[model samples]
Target chain A: MEMFVHDETPTAAVDQREQVVSALAGSVRDLVDATIRSTVADEELLAVRAGVDALVARLRTEQRPGPAGVRYNSEGRSWSWGNAVVGHGNAIAPPLAIDHDTERGRSRAEVVLGAAYEGPPGMVHGGVSALLLDQIMGETASGFKRLTMTGTLTLRYRRPLPLGPVALECWIASEAGRKVTVEASIGNADGVAVEATGLFLVPRWAPLAADEQPEGWRRSAEG
Target chain B: MEMFVHDETPTAAVDQREQVVSALAGSVRDLVDATIRSTVADEELLAVRAGVDALVARLRTEQRPGPAGVRYNSEGRSWSWGNAVVGHGNAIAPPLAIDHDTERGRSRAEVVLGAAYEGPPGMVHGGVSALLLDQIMGETASGFKRLTMTGTLTLRYRRPLPLGPVALECWIASEAGRKVTVEASIGNADGVAVEATGLFLVPRWAPLAADEQPEGWRRSAEG
Candidate 1:
C-alpha cells in the first residue's frame, strides 16, 4: 500500500464534504472556548455534557476505521482533514490560513488565537508556536509535491507572544542532498516572538527530484 | 494585579468545579475523535453540527471574558483549566497526568494518543511530542513552587511514535542561578521516539530561593 492515498473521490464531492467538516470544526472550536470560560451552574454544565455526548454518538454511527489521512484526487485536490496544524476539520487547530508560495520557496499565514490557545497568563503557548512553525516549514520544504519529515526542530523564545493576532512565515533556507533547512518565526505587531530553524529530510523510500513527481504522490492545493 | 491569580474560591468548591469541567472536556474530546473518523452521510453530519452548535450556545450562557489563567487558592490548590498542555477543562490538551517527584527532581506521565493527535500518517505529530515535553519540563523546573518560563526548547525526532500509549519522563538536568536545564523524552513500548532539552528561566522580577515561596504565589497540586 502506498503512503500517499490516491482517493478517487470526485473533486466536487470532496469540496462539499470539506465545507461541511470545516463548518462543524468551527462550531466545536467555539464550544471549546466557551467551555473554558464558562461560569454556568453545575447542573447546566452537566446538561451540556450530556448534549455533547449525544452528538458524539450520532457522529459515530457511521465512521472511518482510522484517521483521515492525507488524500489526493486525480484533479490535484488534496486534504488532510485530521492534520494537527492545518486540518480544516480539526477543532483544536488554531485558525491558521497559510499561503504557499512554492515558486518563491516560502509560506506565510496569519491567525487570531483566542482563549483556547493560551499558556502563560496572556501569552500564546510556546509549543503552539512551535506547532505552527513546524507545519509551515514542513509545507515549505515539501512544496506540496514530495514527502518530508521533520528531522530536528529548534526554537528560541526571544519574546513572549501575547494571545492575539499573530503572523508566521517560513522559507527554505538551504538544501543539501535529501536534507532541507527551513527558517521560520511567529510574531506580532511588535516584532518576532519565536524564531525556529528546522531540518526536514526526504525519506529514502520516497526520494524524487524536485521536478519529478513520485509514483503515488499527487500535488494538491490543500494538505 | 498578580500573574498567578489568588482565587478566593475554597479548595472544596474548586474541586467540585473541576470535576464538572473535566467531565465536560472529556465528552468534547470524544466528540473530536468521532468527528475525525466519521464517515456518516452528509445529512447526518450536518445534523450533528446543529446539535454541537446548540450545546455551545448553552455553555456560553454565562462565560468569562477571557482565558482561564493559572490560579491558586489559600489552601495551595492551583488550577489552570485552560492550559493547552494539561488543562482539565481543555478538550484539546492531551490526556497527560504528570506525577511531580519534587524530592527526586523528576516528573513523569503516560497517555494514549488517539486519532485526534496524528500528523504524519499513523505517527504522532512532532509538535504534539514537543508540547508534552515542554509542559512536563516546565513543571519539573518549577516544582510547583516558583514560576519558570521556557527560554529555549530543542527537540530531535529520533523515531515516529504511533497512535497509542506512550511514556514521558523529565528531570532537572542542571540549574545555574535563575536558569534550569531539563531533559525529557517520549517513548512507546518499543523505545524512545523523541528526545528534548529545554532551558527554563526564572524571571528576575519574581526570583526567590528554591526553598522560599514568592509573595503572590502559592504552591498548588495542579497548574
Candidate 2:
C-alpha cells in the first residue's frame, strides 16, 4: 500500500543537488572497489581506517531523520539516491542508466561491471545479473506512468559475463489485467551472457492507466 | 571453464584474516550507509567530499592486479570476498550470513535491510529480494558440495517487507539430472513477505559428486 510517488513540481535545485551528490557517491563507490582490491600493509590499512571513521562521523553530524525517501519535483523528475539498483548515492548499487522506448515497449542499458561485482573467477556475479535484470524488468513494466512490483523473475546465465562493459536489453513481453511479463538479457559485444524473464504485478490499489500516458515516464532519473 | 575450487587443505590463517578483514569492511559499510543518510550542508558536504576523495586516492595507490579472483587455500578453505551477495570485503553487499542444514537439505539466513537496499517506500528493494534468493538458492542447490548457477528465478512479492531485521529460508524442492529446484521465502516477524522458486543448473562440466566426498563444505562461514 505504501510506495513512492514523485508527482511534484520540478526543482532545478534538487536536480543540481543530486548531480553533485551522485558525483561524490561515484567517488566513494570507486573507493570501495579500491579498498577491496588494495594490498596495503596491515599497519597502513589500520591507520587509514581511523581517518575513514572520522569522515563518517563528520558526515553523520547532520543526517536525514531516516532513509532518504524517494523524491520528485513538479516536473515528475524523481530521484532515489538510496535505491539499490539506480541509487546515485549508493556505491553498492551498480551505476546503471536504463533507457526505455515506451512506444515500442522496449528498453536498453549499458554499464561497466567492475571488480566490486565479480562472482566467479573474473566473471560478473550471478546475483548482480539478477539484480540488474529485475530492476530493468520492473522499470519496463512500470515506465513511471503506473506503479508495478516484481512478481516473479527467471534468469539463465548462459555464459560468463566478463567484468567490463556490458549491455542489457528488456521489453514488455505480455500483459494482462494485473500481471505484466518482461523479457531481458545482458551481454557484451560477443553476445548475450545472461537472459531473464520477469512477471510484474500492478497492485490493485494502483491500477494501470486507462489511456496512454505522456512520455513523462522517462523521469526514472530516480528509479 | 575456470572456477573456484576449494578441494584442498584448509588454512587457519586465512580464516583468521577473513574475520579481521570482515570486521573492517563492516565499518566501511557503515560509513557508506551513513553517507547516504547525511543531510549535511552544501559547504560541509563539499569540504568532506575533498577529504573523502583524498582518502580514495591514497587507497588506490596500490591495487590488485585485477578483480580479486576467488581464492581457495590449500586446506580447501575457500574465501571469495568479492561476491556481491556475501563477499566480506564488499561494503555494498548486504551483510548476509546464510546457514545451511545439509542434513535437512535447507538453508536459513538473517540480515538487516539498510537504506542501501530500499526500493519502494520503506520496503526492501524487489531486486535485492531476488539477489538474496538467488544466492541462497544456489547455495542450497550446491550445498557447497558442487557448483551451481541460477538458471531461472521466480519470485512473488506477496506484500511489502519493512526495513530492518528480516529472515529468509530456502530448501531443495526437487531435482532431476542437472537441474535442481529450490523454494525460498523472506519475511520479518510476520509470515512470508516474498516467496521465490529457483531452478539451478549443474553444468555438465561441473557434475555432482560421484562418490563419497570429504566434508569440505563448511556451509560458508560467512554466507
Candidate 3:
C-alpha cells in the first residue's frame, strides 16, 4: 500500500491524499478477500499473522497515542482511516467506497464478501450486512456536512446473501430536529437480500451548529 | 446444565427438549469464548480446529434439511434456537434470557460477556450491546403478546462498559397501528452505561388480530 507522511504542502494537498487513500483502501479490500479464500496451510497462516503483528508493532512505535480521529484540510477534504465503515486501513471494513449524489440525497457502493464475512454456509453474516447498512444510512442522514449517530436501525433479511459481489444503496427519507430517517438496501445481481430503515440522531449532547461540529462528525457524515 | 425431558406430561416433554437445546447452546457459547481467549500453541490450535470440524461433521449427520425457523407450541411456549438476537443455540449470541413484566410493559435480563464480546480493551463490544438492546426492545414493543420487528433503534454509549455482568431494562413508551416505541438501558453494579430508544414494526404482512397471531409471537412478546 502507498504511504505518505504529513509535509509542508498547501491544504490543497487534499486531492492527492484522497487519491492515495482510495488506492490503499482498494488494496486492503483485496487483501481481506485473499485472506478469506486463501488455501494456505496452518503453518503459513501462523507466519502471516506473525508478520502482520510485527508490522503493527512497527507502526505503533511511530504513531500518536490514541484512536485516529477524523482529520481535514482547509480545502474541505477529510479522511478517517480508522472508520469501521469506510476506513482505508481497516481490513475488517469490507472497505466500501461510497459515492454520494448530493442533488438526489442518495449514495451507493459495491462490494464483495468472501470467507471472512460468511455465516451460513456460503451466505454473508447477517451482522456484517447490518454494519454496512449502518454506515451508509448514517452517511445519508448526515448528508455529508452534518453530525448524526445511528439512533435506530431496522433490517429485514428476506433471503440469504451469497458471498460474492453485491451492491448497497441508501438515501435520506426525512429529517427533523436532531433526527434524520434513512432507507437502505443490500442486494446481489438477482435481487435485494436485505432492507433497512434507520433513525439517526444528533445526540442531545452533540453540537448542532454546522461549523462547530467535530471533524469526526464531518468525515463520517460526508464521506 | 440442567436436563428436564419427560415424554409423559406434554409441557414436561416440551421443557425437556428445551433443556437439551439450552445445554447445546451453552456449549456453543463456551466454545466461542474459548476460541476468543485461547492462547494455545499453534499446533494445539490446529488440533482444536480439527476437533471442531469433526464435531461439526458428526452433528450434520442427522440434521434437519432446512434452516431452523421459529417454532412454538400449542400451550403458548416458543423457541427460536437460530434467532440472531435471542437464539438458544447460537454461539454468537450472549444468549440473553429476557423476563417480561406485562403489567408494567417492561422487560429485564442479566448476562455476562467474556472475551468473545470484547471490542476495546476490557470493554464489551459495542455491537454486542446493540444486539442485546435490540432483542429487549423488540420484546417490549411486542408486549409479549404480539409480533414486532425492529424498525429503528438509537443508542448512546455514555461510557465504555467493562466485560462482565450487566443488567438490561426495557419498557414500552407508546404504540401505533404498526409501530411500537421502546426505551431501554444497560448498566453494571455501578450504574448505567448506555441508553437506547427504538421503534418496532409489525410488518404490514403480519397479522394484527390477537387470536390469529402466531404462538411464537405471543410467547416472545408476552412472556
The candidate scoring highest on lDDT is: 1
Number of the predicted model whose DockQ against the real structure is largest: 1
Which ten residues in a row are the worst by lDDT in model 1 chain B?
B214-223
Q: For every model shown, what is its TM-score relative to the native structure? A: 0.95, 0.90, 0.56
Write candidate 3's Cα lDDT for A107-189 as tens digits. Answer: 99999765445433345555567667766776777776666655555666676687689999998898778888889999999
Measured against the native two-chain assembly using Cα atoms, what DockQ does each of the candidate structures obtain, in the order listed? 0.60, 0.54, 0.05
Comparison by lDDT, 1 against 3, better one: 1
Each candidate structure's count of clashing pairs: 1, 17, 11
What are the Cα lDDT values of the candidates? Answer: 0.82, 0.75, 0.59
Going through the candidates in order, what fraction of the true interface contacts does each contain?
0.67, 0.59, 0.02
Task: Give TM-scores of the second chain, every candidate.
Answer: 0.94, 0.88, 0.86
Off by over 4 Å in 3: A1-223, B1-10, B204-209, B212-216, B219-223
Arranged by DockQ with the best first, the candidates are 1, 2, 3
Write one digit per residue (lDDT tens) for candidate 1, span B1-91.
Answer: 1166878999999999999999999999888888888888888888888888888888888988888888877777788888888889999
What shift in Å separates residue B105 of candidate 3 from its native position after superposition?
0.4
Q: What is the lDDT, from 0 to 100, of the residue B73 in candidate 3?
A: 57
Instruction: Give the residue spans of candidate 2 off by over 4 A.
Output: A1-10, A210-223, B5-10, B210-223
lDDT of 2 by residue, B17-116 (tens): 6766676677678777887898887677677778778877777788787776677765556777777778888787776788889777899999998888
Per-candidate RMSD, Å: 2.3, 3.3, 10.6
| Candidate 2, A11-85: lDDT as tens digits | 777777777778768877877787678776666666667777888898899887667667655565667788888
